[model samples]
Target chain A: MNTVFFLVFGLIVVVCAINVVVQRHPISSAISLIGVMGSLAIIYLQLGAEFMAAAQIIVYTGAVMVLFIFVIMLLNAGSEEGGKGPLTVRLLGVPLLLVFLGLLSYLIQRLFSDTGPVRFGDFKGGSPADVGRALFSTYLLPFEITSVLILIAILGAIVLARKELD
Target chain B: MPAAVPLSWYLVLSAVLFSLGVAGFFFRRNIITMFMSIELMLNAVNLSFVAFSFQLKQVSGNIFAFFVMVVAAAEAAVGLAIILTVFKNRATLNVDRIDSMKY
Candidate 1:
């Protein structure tokens, strides 16, 4: 029953994700992206991670996607007309994708054959409390560095976006 | 109640989603769509991380997901701001045409 549940939602996410790329209009792509993220949140719920599922919906689908849509609207970006460039891009991508797929398949087979089952000894009973401790303790430096990186990205984005005053 | 699903199922789904995101990143022309594609890729990886954490019964995945959320937030704010500015100046947001900064 649960397998069926995951399979169905997973298929839906795949379809919507493809739509995110195939749609000609940016708004439609955003809509499809929302659908994809929402389904992913549902998958997280079925996996027994309520907090993650909520964050999936609230952060990505709710906040980030809305921001994307707002930018699209503000830009008034018109639907891309059928054009030669996109077609050429697609044509070039196909073979490269095939090569990557082959390489990834080989790597997966190699990893499983060599490693047997992964050892997850320390990962059991995962909880928000555990996450909090790990973040502030073992992973503290990485966390702080990531914060600094985000700050730099914000500052850089502002610099890039600022209009030159005449 | 039924046959148990293996952890590999979730991993496979994540891989598929990640690949689709990659395809979108390469194929899409609009900058916003490209950014959305990047977000998709990030979320797909997060799914795999959470799945592995679940299978291992650890909290590291949850913590990583939290960090990913922070980065995604920052990316959204900065990325959208840049997009808005590009549109205001160029009056277009197509990725191919924004080569003004290039020498």
Candidate 2:
């Protein structure tokens, strides 16, 4: 049952992610990326990290994807010739891509092959509460720094997007 | 009974997703798609984090996942904004054509 669910969710995410790349228009690509993120949040829920799942949906799907779409719409961003480019230049990446594919498969095999028994049980008492405790207690510094980083990002984005100071 | 799936399944799923992201990152011409590929890679890492968290029977992995989400959010906001600003100045978002930053 879990395997089936995992496969389905993973398939959904992979498919949408590919669509995000293949879609010519930026707006549609953003939309497809939202679907990918949404499926990932669902996978998080299945892992029993409820708070993480919620945060994934709220932050990635709700906040970030919308921001991406908004920027696309505001700029009216589009590709010349609906995404056509010089075939020679584009195909120049083919050999590099083949190299990447080789490296990826090697890494995947090396990582997953030596694994022991797949532990498929739940944490005895871990819950969202435990997550909060860890966030504030052990990982507090990084947590605080991440907030500051986000603030800087927001300000920087606004500054970049703003047309004029006056 | 809720069937138990192995950790390798998640790990393998993540690897596949990550590879797809890599392909998109290199092959795609559009900056937006490239950003989406980055997001895909991040989610792939999150999958591995969750799987390892479950394997280790610890809550720390979830914590890391949260942090990754925060960073991803910030990245999306800043990256997309930069793409937009670049488009405004150059009139096209093709990364090849926009080489103003090249030294």
The Cα error of candidate 1 at residue B73, in Å, is 1.6
- Judged by DockQ cut-offs, the docking class of candidate 2 is medium
Please give, for residues A1-166, the per-residue lDDT of candidate 2 as tens digits. 6767777888898788778767777787788888888888887777767787788888888888888787778777775244555787477665766576577667766776665544323543236788989989999999999989999999998998788767
- Error of model 2, residue A73, in angstroms: 1.3
DockQ, per model, reads 0.49, 0.55
Across B1-103, the per-residue lDDT of candidate 2 in tens digits comes to: 3355656767767877777787778666777778878988998898888777866778999888888888888888888878877887887767777776796
| Residue B94, candidate 1: alpha-carbon lDDT | 75
lDDT of 1 at A29: 93
How accurate locally is residue A43 in candidate 1, as Cα lDDT from 0 to 100?
76
Model 1, span B1-103: residue lDDT tens? 3344556667767877888899888877788888888988998988887876676566777778778888888888887887887778787767778888785
lDDT of each: 0.77, 0.77
- TM accuracy, model 1: 0.83
List TM-score per model, in order.
Answer: 0.83, 0.86
Candidate 1 chain A, run of 10 with poorest lDDT: A114-123
